[model samples]
Target chain A: MTRNTRLLMSMIFWAFIIYLFLPLIMMVMMGFKDSEFIGFPIRSWTFKWYQVAINDMEVLGIFAYSMTIAISTTILSLIIGTWAAMALGPTKFRGKFILFALACLPAVIPGIISAISLRIYAQSLDITPGMWAIILGHTVHNVPFVTLVGIARLNSQPESHIDAALDLGADNVIAFMRITLPFLVPSLIGAGIFCMLTSFDDFVRSFFLGGYEPTLPVYIFSQLRTGMSPEINAISAIILLITAALGLSAERLMRRNKKKV
Target chain B: MQTNDSTVRLQNISKKFGSVVAVEDFDIFIEPGQFVTLLGPSGCGKSTTLRILGGFIEPTEGEVFLGDDKVTKIPPNRRNVNMVFQDYALFPHMTVSENIAFGLEMKGQNKAQIKKRIDELLEFMQLDGFGDRKPDELSGGQRQRVALARALAPDPKVLLLDEPLGALDAKLRKQVQIELKTIQQQTGKTFVFVTHDQEEALTMSDRILVMNEGRLEQDGSPKDLYYHPETTFVAGFIGETNMLSCSVKKIDDDYVVLDWQGNELRGVCRSGTAKEGQDVSAAIRPESISCSAKKPGNKGVMKAKIIHRVFKGSFTSLSLEVDGVKDCILNATLAGALAEQLGDEEVWISLDPDYLSVLLR
Candidate 1:
């Protein structure tokens, strides 16, 4: 309430931010170090470590593979989640709460538990441990987030919008396509970005379900066991920068959309 | 052959939600090119009836027809009627031109025709430069006009409006009411509007259907309802009225004479058949009471003292208490500025018998 209290609070908040970013800052700084082994005394810094990761053909391949899995997961979850949202948008039947909870259950489940269960499920179905398996695991995890965002956006939409479309001589399908789909575009895009980020950053599921071919996260994780190096730090710093940029933009979009409606 | 080209016809329509009766045994027939309004208080089934006409709500029991076709089983999209919702419900994602072009697109109009219609509607609504703006970019009044333009683009058999101007301020509402009436006339479209504002109903409707508690209380013109309300609810709901209890003395060919406080007052018998020496209820508009400084020897003149005078912008309202009345007061409105001499002064008040509505108890 007072100036002293405000000053103290600001200091505390900055301290918390610094604590949260200390490791990420150190990791990024370590990528510029010329030393083979990481240490605080940066007597010299070079671009060789960054060049090593950037020029590595295997790292580049893993990046593309991870992007493919993320895209696939996003597309699958988007379809399933939007349908789930539309089905639940205006319903008032009994068991609706249970149905909705089941749809969102994967998001709250432990990631490792889901990873083990998905690997087992894939095995029982005789689906090999590979890209399909990893994509399936990522989609199951990402769908709940997509559905949650989609439902919130859909519910906030005016019921009369659909009615207006129908009154304008649009059939039900046409109304959804013309009115409802456009209305949901912003939220679906937000959810899509979120799915890609989460699927790209995912490690446990890809580790359990991936084949000899590895995604970027799984690949980085395997490289970590070989021993932590400046090149590994460089790759991680690039990933951190990417996810941070995507997350900040998604948040800004949601805030702007919130103010609009 | 059964339908006589009525734009909309509802026969014995009723809707029950669980134990609640939303609309019961309602029947209305709307002629083409007429501006009709369903006027009632909230929860009086006026909106339900409008929705039923639009094919958005299926009546529990009834037949709905748009012109000669029975459309009771049809959905809203297939029906020949469209609605301007209370909130306007403009598509936020679409620009003004896109919104106006939507119905035309659905009508399968070519791009050229759609473009022409959009331009025409934009100019018609006076939103020419605002064509590329989204709904959120426009003000409330602009959004409302955009919604109206969208509904009108389809050229439907009937246009239903559910209190579309209920969201506007008083000045804007009055302006829009005139615009709506003008548009209805210019387009030659049958418009069935729903509203609780009696003033709005009177200003726009060619015919007004007064409803109360799911029943058709009265169906007539604005002048008819205002001058001769059939029931006490209709009398009170439409405008300010003095519901005075009086005894009918005798029924003339045109007017019924009633005895109020030892004076004989004449009132029109509009509700039911009048009887001799029977207790009755009559509705008298305050504006109908003529105030005189001098005691006039009129048939129904009453000496009253002005209890309070409220100066409304264009008129002054005077509250009067009759000499013989107990614990009761009557109201009279004097137009324009009045001299202070008439304030809080005893004056002779006479009722215009033609404006007095008599009802049987």
Candidate 2:
């Protein structure tokens, strides 16, 4: 209530805000710097790094590959995760808790461990490590998030809606498609965006399972090892912008669905 | 649209969930165009019985018949029945017209026919011009009407309603009760309504089925159940009644003499055997007993002291204590004006022999 306390609270709040955004701000600023080095007082500003990054055929190819894997991962996770959530949402069965915990194991375990274990499993199955393997790894990591969100959405829905649908002459498949699926749209969209972002930003799993074909994140990591460059900063800024736009659109869709319901 | 064989028959239906019996040996025959109510307290199997009729759940034992067809193992979608849920379960995302058109569309009706049916239902339910509004945009009573319209759109043989007006306010509920009965009469469909409210059942149903503890206690016309209850449960459940324990002094073909606190009172025995010298209970409705400040020269008149008088607008309920009636309290419904004159004074109480329901304990 005191003036000093209010000032101190505002100071701490701004410090926390800066702690989160300062790195992002610095990366964005470095993307515009003219110098090859990433840090220090800016001598000049230019879009040369962005141009170079966009013109590099290898970087562009890696970005396209990452987009493909991320999109595939999102689609696969959405289908499998929504199905699992629907099965587990409104019923009681033996070993349900154990099954849920096992489903969530990949999300909670260290990513390095899962990546190594998956590589070993793939090798045992005589499967080659490539884009498919990376996509599989990303899906395992993202399905649990989708399932959790889906379960929360499904649990909040009233059971009588489905009962009413059936009582009004709808078959089982029709009831699910009309009532249950519509009710789950907002959560599905949100979870898809989350899974896509997670897959696009993932590095460790892609590095371990990607073999010769490097994704965008793996390519960035390799560039970092060579030396920090403005081109890497440019790509990072672009990824950040895409993710922010996706998050904003997801929120808008959720609000729109809320109004409809 | 076949109205002749629209009767619903349930033969020896029993349902059990896990170790609990939800309904046991339930049997009833609902004739076409009859408005029957399954009345009971919460968790007393009324809703369960309605659900069984709707084919939402299969009874563990017994058969369900719609017209002449056996439908015990049929799914809900295959049955010619629809239900208005307790919560009015209108789809939140759909407009009122869309919700009403759902069943008709599922029946393979053309778009034009569906639209025409929906318009008719909307007008019938007094929900005209609200068809484009979603459920959340409508009031509770409006949503309930929409739910009813949706269920009736397909013109099924039977319409089931599970406490459909439960979420409305008192005034809205009363209005809906009258509207619901009128609609059922107009549709000429067999309506199976479920509710725990006795007054609603008495006001709306042509036949009332009283259930207690997952078993049917009594089933008859409203007046029949009220005047001739077969058991103590039915007497206590149907309406307000004062139960007085007495010993049977003598038994006749039509009436029985019960000795109540050394006073021999004769009442008609409508159910159960009346053995001489056996203990029994008599259920007398409060409205059947007349109370006067001065002693009346009537055959069944008894002197009792007024313990308390509760003024309930239309009628005053007088709680009386009679001499030698040790553990039993008698209640009489007197006019407010008459009850105001007899304050803390001895009054004469007369029991109508015809209205007194004698039951064997």
What are the fnat scores of the candidates, in the order listed?
0.86, 0.77
Misplaced by over 4 Å in model 2 are A1-10, A51-57, A248-261, B1-4, B340-344
Reference-based lDDT, residue A194, model 1: 92
For model 2 chain A, the run of ten residues with the poorest summed lDDT: A252-261
Off by over 4 Å in 1: A1-7, B1-6, B249-252, B261-263, B275-278, B336-344
Weakest 10 consecutive residues, lDDT, candidate 1 chain B? Answer: B336-345
The residue-by-residue lDDT of candidate 2 on A1-261, one tens digit each, is 999999999999999999999999999999999998989899999999989988989889999999999999999999999988987787789999998998878899999999999999878887789988998999999999888888878887888899988887788899989999888988899889989999999988998898798899888888889998899999898889989999889878766765554
Model 1 over residues A1-261: C-alpha lDDT tens digits?
999999999999999999999998999999999998987899898989889999999889889999999999999999999999987777588999999999999999999999999999999999999999999999999999888988888888888988899899899899999999988888888899999999999999999999999898887777778887899989988888889999888888877777776
State the displacement of the C-alpha of residue A121, model 2, in Å, after optimal TM-score superposition: 2.8
Clashing pairs in 1: none
- Predict model 2's lDDT versus the native: 0.89
